[model samples]
Target: MDTFVWRDDYSVGYTPIDEQHQELFKRINAFGNALWEGQGKELLAAHLRFLADYVVSHFQTEEGLMTTHKFPLYEVHKPVHDAFVQEVSSVLNRIADAGLDTATAILVFEKSCDWTRAHVRGMDQELGRFLGAQRNSTAA
Candidate 1:
Protein backbone atom coordinates (compact mmCIF):
# COMPACT_ATOMS: atom_id res chain seq x y z
CA MET A 1 0.00 0.00 0.00
CA ASP A 2 1.19 3.51 -0.77
CA THR A 3 0.75 4.95 2.70
CA PHE A 4 -1.36 8.01 3.22
CA VAL A 5 0.91 11.03 3.13
CA TRP A 6 -0.26 14.27 4.58
CA ARG A 7 0.46 17.12 2.24
CA ASP A 8 0.15 20.81 2.99
CA ASP A 9 -2.49 20.78 0.31
CA TYR A 10 -4.54 18.51 2.53
CA SER A 11 -5.02 21.17 5.14
CA VAL A 12 -8.57 22.41 5.39
CA GLY A 13 -7.43 25.73 6.87
CA TYR A 14 -9.23 24.66 10.03
CA THR A 15 -7.04 23.48 12.82
CA PRO A 16 -9.36 20.86 14.29
CA ILE A 17 -10.34 19.36 10.96
CA ASP A 18 -6.76 19.30 9.69
CA GLU A 19 -5.56 17.72 12.90
CA GLN A 20 -8.19 15.01 12.71
CA HIS A 21 -7.32 14.39 9.08
CA GLN A 22 -3.68 13.93 10.00
CA GLU A 23 -4.62 11.61 12.83
CA LEU A 24 -6.59 9.48 10.39
CA PHE A 25 -3.51 9.13 8.20
CA LYS A 26 -1.35 8.32 11.18
CA ARG A 27 -3.70 5.53 12.24
CA ILE A 28 -3.80 4.16 8.71
CA ASN A 29 0.00 4.11 8.59
CA ALA A 30 0.19 2.34 11.92
CA PHE A 31 -2.24 -0.28 10.67
CA GLY A 32 -0.23 -0.66 7.50
CA ASN A 33 2.89 -1.24 9.55
CA ALA A 34 1.08 -4.01 11.41
CA LEU A 35 0.15 -5.57 8.08
CA TRP A 36 3.76 -5.33 7.00
CA GLU A 37 4.69 -7.32 10.08
CA GLY A 38 2.17 -10.03 9.12
CA GLN A 39 -0.25 -9.24 11.91
CA GLY A 40 -3.02 -8.15 9.60
CA LYS A 41 -5.58 -10.86 10.30
CA GLU A 42 -5.30 -10.84 14.04
CA LEU A 43 -5.63 -7.08 14.15
CA LEU A 44 -7.95 -6.36 11.23
CA ALA A 45 -11.25 -6.36 13.04
CA ALA A 46 -10.02 -4.21 15.90
CA HIS A 47 -8.43 -1.80 13.49
CA LEU A 48 -11.57 -1.49 11.42
CA ARG A 49 -13.69 -0.93 14.50
CA PHE A 50 -11.31 1.68 15.79
CA LEU A 51 -11.25 3.39 12.42
CA ALA A 52 -15.01 3.34 12.15
CA ASP A 53 -15.37 4.83 15.62
CA TYR A 54 -12.72 7.45 15.00
CA VAL A 55 -14.33 8.43 11.73
CA VAL A 56 -17.64 8.93 13.47
CA SER A 57 -15.96 11.17 15.99
CA HIS A 58 -14.34 13.19 13.25
CA PHE A 59 -17.61 13.43 11.36
CA GLN A 60 -19.34 14.72 14.45
CA THR A 61 -16.75 17.44 14.75
CA GLU A 62 -17.32 18.50 11.18
CA GLU A 63 -21.08 18.35 11.52
CA GLY A 64 -20.95 20.45 14.65
CA LEU A 65 -18.83 23.05 12.97
CA MET A 66 -21.13 23.18 9.99
CA THR A 67 -24.21 23.56 12.12
CA THR A 68 -22.59 26.17 14.28
CA HIS A 69 -21.45 28.16 11.28
CA LYS A 70 -24.67 27.57 9.37
CA PHE A 71 -22.82 26.10 6.39
CA PRO A 72 -25.08 25.78 3.39
CA LEU A 73 -23.72 22.43 2.35
CA TYR A 74 -24.33 20.54 5.57
CA GLU A 75 -27.32 18.77 4.12
CA VAL A 76 -25.37 17.52 1.13
CA HIS A 77 -22.17 16.82 3.07
CA LYS A 78 -23.59 14.85 6.00
CA PRO A 79 -25.21 12.19 3.88
CA VAL A 80 -21.82 11.46 2.37
CA HIS A 81 -20.47 10.82 5.82
CA ASP A 82 -23.44 8.60 6.55
CA ALA A 83 -22.74 6.59 3.43
CA PHE A 84 -19.12 6.06 4.43
CA VAL A 85 -20.19 4.94 7.85
CA GLN A 86 -22.51 2.43 6.27
CA GLU A 87 -19.75 1.23 3.97
CA VAL A 88 -17.44 0.69 6.90
CA SER A 89 -20.18 -1.15 8.72
CA SER A 90 -20.67 -3.40 5.72
CA VAL A 91 -16.96 -4.15 5.49
CA LEU A 92 -16.81 -4.94 9.15
CA ASN A 93 -19.62 -7.44 8.71
CA ARG A 94 -17.94 -8.97 5.66
CA ILE A 95 -14.71 -9.39 7.52
CA ALA A 96 -16.53 -11.00 10.38
CA ASP A 97 -18.27 -13.42 8.06
CA ALA A 98 -15.45 -14.40 5.70
CA GLY A 99 -12.36 -13.96 7.86
CA LEU A 100 -10.28 -11.52 5.83
CA ASP A 101 -6.79 -12.09 4.50
CA THR A 102 -3.87 -9.69 4.28
CA ALA A 103 -4.84 -8.72 0.76
CA THR A 104 -8.37 -7.75 1.74
CA ALA A 105 -7.08 -5.83 4.72
CA ILE A 106 -4.81 -3.88 2.43
CA LEU A 107 -7.72 -3.12 0.12
CA VAL A 108 -9.65 -1.68 3.05
CA PHE A 109 -6.75 0.55 3.88
CA GLU A 110 -6.33 1.67 0.30
CA LYS A 111 -9.99 2.45 -0.21
CA SER A 112 -10.15 4.47 2.99
CA CYS A 113 -7.00 6.37 2.16
CA ASP A 114 -8.25 7.11 -1.33
CA TRP A 115 -11.63 8.26 -0.02
CA THR A 116 -10.08 10.60 2.53
CA ARG A 117 -7.72 12.19 0.04
CA ALA A 118 -10.54 12.83 -2.38
CA HIS A 119 -12.94 14.07 0.28
CA VAL A 120 -10.38 16.42 1.74
CA ARG A 121 -9.36 17.71 -1.66
CA GLY A 122 -12.94 18.24 -2.67
CA MET A 123 -15.70 19.17 -0.21
CA ASP A 124 -13.46 19.74 2.79
CA GLN A 125 -11.49 22.35 0.87
CA GLU A 126 -14.67 24.16 0.10
CA LEU A 127 -15.57 23.92 3.79
CA GLY A 128 -12.20 25.30 4.73
CA ARG A 129 -12.67 28.29 2.47
CA PHE A 130 -16.10 28.92 3.89
CA LEU A 131 -14.93 28.67 7.49
CA GLY A 132 -11.90 30.85 6.80
CA ALA A 133 -14.09 33.50 5.30
CA GLN A 134 -16.38 33.29 8.27
CA ARG A 135 -13.47 33.69 10.64
CA ASN A 136 -12.13 36.62 8.72
CA SER A 137 -15.48 38.35 8.59
CA THR A 138 -16.00 37.89 12.31
CA ALA A 139 -12.54 39.24 13.06
CA ALA A 140 -13.08 42.21 10.78
Candidate 2:
Protein backbone atom coordinates (compact mmCIF):
# COMPACT_ATOMS: atom_id res chain seq x y z
CA MET A 1 0.00 0.00 0.00
CA ASP A 2 2.76 2.41 0.97
CA THR A 3 5.23 3.20 -1.77
CA PHE A 4 8.87 2.60 -0.87
CA VAL A 5 11.38 5.21 -1.92
CA TRP A 6 15.13 5.30 -1.36
CA ARG A 7 16.28 8.03 0.95
CA ASP A 8 19.66 9.55 1.82
CA ASP A 9 19.33 8.24 5.36
CA TYR A 10 19.56 4.70 4.00
CA SER A 11 23.19 4.98 2.88
CA VAL A 12 25.65 2.97 4.96
CA GLY A 13 28.62 5.09 3.82
CA TYR A 14 30.50 2.26 2.09
CA THR A 15 30.41 2.74 -1.65
CA PRO A 16 30.25 -0.89 -2.76
CA ILE A 17 27.73 -1.90 -0.15
CA ASP A 18 25.69 1.21 -0.79
CA GLU A 19 25.56 0.44 -4.47
CA GLN A 20 24.45 -3.11 -3.82
CA HIS A 21 21.80 -1.87 -1.42
CA GLN A 22 20.52 0.53 -4.01
CA GLU A 23 20.33 -2.23 -6.60
CA LEU A 24 18.47 -4.43 -4.18
CA PHE A 25 15.98 -1.66 -3.51
CA LYS A 26 15.53 -1.07 -7.20
CA ARG A 27 14.83 -4.73 -7.91
CA ILE A 28 12.44 -5.07 -5.02
CA ASN A 29 10.59 -1.94 -6.01
CA ALA A 30 10.19 -3.27 -9.52
CA PHE A 31 8.71 -6.46 -8.16
CA GLY A 32 6.35 -4.47 -5.97
CA ASN A 33 5.25 -2.36 -8.89
CA ALA A 34 4.50 -5.42 -10.96
CA LEU A 35 2.31 -6.74 -8.21
CA TRP A 36 0.54 -3.41 -7.75
CA GLU A 37 -0.26 -3.28 -11.43
CA GLY A 38 -2.28 -6.51 -11.09
CA GLN A 39 0.08 -8.29 -13.38
CA GLY A 40 -0.46 -11.86 -14.48
CA LYS A 41 0.57 -14.65 -12.16
CA GLU A 42 3.36 -15.78 -14.46
CA LEU A 43 4.85 -12.30 -14.65
CA LEU A 44 4.66 -11.87 -10.88
CA ALA A 45 6.38 -15.20 -10.34
CA ALA A 46 9.14 -14.25 -12.72
CA HIS A 47 9.77 -10.98 -10.93
CA LEU A 48 9.73 -12.71 -7.57
CA ARG A 49 12.27 -15.24 -8.77
CA PHE A 50 14.47 -12.48 -10.13
CA LEU A 51 14.34 -10.69 -6.79
CA ALA A 52 15.24 -13.86 -4.90
CA ASP A 53 18.21 -14.56 -7.11
CA TYR A 54 19.47 -11.00 -6.84
CA VAL A 55 19.17 -11.02 -3.05
CA VAL A 56 21.18 -14.23 -2.78
CA SER A 57 23.93 -12.94 -5.05
CA HIS A 58 24.11 -9.58 -3.33
CA PHE A 59 24.13 -11.14 0.12
CA GLN A 60 27.04 -13.35 -0.91
CA THR A 61 29.01 -10.32 -1.97
CA GLU A 62 28.22 -8.51 1.25
CA GLU A 63 29.05 -11.53 3.37
CA GLY A 64 32.32 -12.11 1.58
CA LEU A 65 33.39 -8.53 2.13
CA MET A 66 32.57 -8.78 5.82
CA THR A 67 34.56 -11.98 6.13
CA THR A 68 37.56 -10.52 4.31
CA HIS A 69 37.50 -7.45 6.53
CA LYS A 70 37.06 -9.59 9.65
CA PHE A 71 34.11 -7.52 10.71
CA PRO A 72 33.61 -7.86 14.43
CA LEU A 73 29.91 -8.67 14.10
CA TYR A 74 30.15 -11.01 11.13
CA GLU A 75 28.79 -13.88 13.14
CA VAL A 76 25.80 -11.89 14.26
CA HIS A 77 25.27 -10.29 10.88
CA LYS A 78 25.26 -13.47 8.78
CA PRO A 79 22.13 -14.90 10.30
CA VAL A 80 20.21 -11.96 8.90
CA HIS A 81 21.25 -13.03 5.42
CA ASP A 82 20.38 -16.64 6.15
CA ALA A 83 16.96 -15.65 7.43
CA PHE A 84 16.29 -13.64 4.28
CA VAL A 85 17.14 -16.62 2.10
CA GLN A 86 14.78 -18.76 4.09
CA GLU A 87 12.03 -16.17 3.94
CA VAL A 88 12.36 -15.89 0.19
CA SER A 89 12.22 -19.63 -0.16
CA SER A 90 9.06 -19.75 1.92
CA VAL A 91 7.41 -17.06 -0.20
CA LEU A 92 8.29 -18.94 -3.34
CA ASN A 93 6.68 -22.02 -1.92
CA ARG A 94 3.57 -20.09 -1.04
CA ILE A 95 3.40 -18.58 -4.50
CA ALA A 96 3.74 -22.01 -6.02
CA ASP A 97 0.98 -23.42 -3.87
CA ALA A 98 -1.46 -20.50 -3.89
CA GLY A 99 -0.69 -19.15 -7.36
CA LEU A 100 0.53 -15.62 -6.61
CA ASP A 101 -2.56 -13.63 -5.79
CA THR A 102 -1.86 -9.93 -6.13
CA ALA A 103 -2.71 -8.93 -2.60
CA THR A 104 -0.80 -11.74 -0.95
CA ALA A 105 2.17 -11.32 -3.21
CA ILE A 106 2.25 -7.61 -2.54
CA LEU A 107 2.22 -8.19 1.21
CA VAL A 108 5.08 -10.64 1.03
CA PHE A 109 7.01 -8.38 -1.30
CA GLU A 110 6.62 -5.47 1.09
CA LYS A 111 7.88 -7.59 3.95
CA SER A 112 10.97 -8.49 1.95
CA CYS A 113 11.58 -4.83 1.18
CA ASP A 114 11.18 -3.88 4.83
CA TRP A 115 13.59 -6.55 5.96
CA THR A 116 16.21 -5.41 3.47
CA ARG A 117 15.92 -1.77 4.47
CA ALA A 118 16.21 -2.63 8.14
CA HIS A 119 19.20 -4.91 7.62
CA VAL A 120 21.00 -2.32 5.53
CA ARG A 121 20.34 0.45 7.99
CA GLY A 122 21.18 -1.56 11.07
CA MET A 123 23.73 -4.33 10.41
CA ASP A 124 25.32 -3.08 7.20
CA GLN A 125 25.65 0.44 8.50
CA GLU A 126 27.49 -0.80 11.57
CA LEU A 127 29.74 -2.96 9.45
CA GLY A 128 30.54 0.04 7.27
CA ARG A 129 31.57 2.04 10.29
CA PHE A 130 33.72 -0.80 11.58
CA LEU A 131 35.43 -1.30 8.26
CA GLY A 132 36.01 2.40 7.80
CA ALA A 133 37.52 2.70 11.25
CA GLN A 134 39.76 -0.28 10.62
CA ARG A 135 41.00 1.18 7.37
CA ASN A 136 41.66 4.55 8.95
CA SER A 137 43.46 3.01 11.88
CA THR A 138 45.66 0.93 9.64
CA ALA A 139 46.49 3.95 7.51
CA ALA A 140 47.60 5.93 10.54
TM-score of each: 0.92, 0.91
> In order, what is each prediction's RMSD in angstroms?
1.7, 1.9
lDDT of each residue in 30-126, candidate 2, tens digit only: 8888887888888888888898899999989988989898887889989978987998888898787556778778777878877877888899889
* Candidate 2 pairs with clashing backbones: none
Q: Each prediction's Cα lDDT score?
A: 0.86, 0.84
lDDT of 1 at 132: 96
How far in Å is the alpha carbon of 47 misplaced in model 2?
Answer: 0.6
lDDT of 1 by residue, 70-140 (tens): 99999999999999999988888888855558898888878988999999999998999999999999999
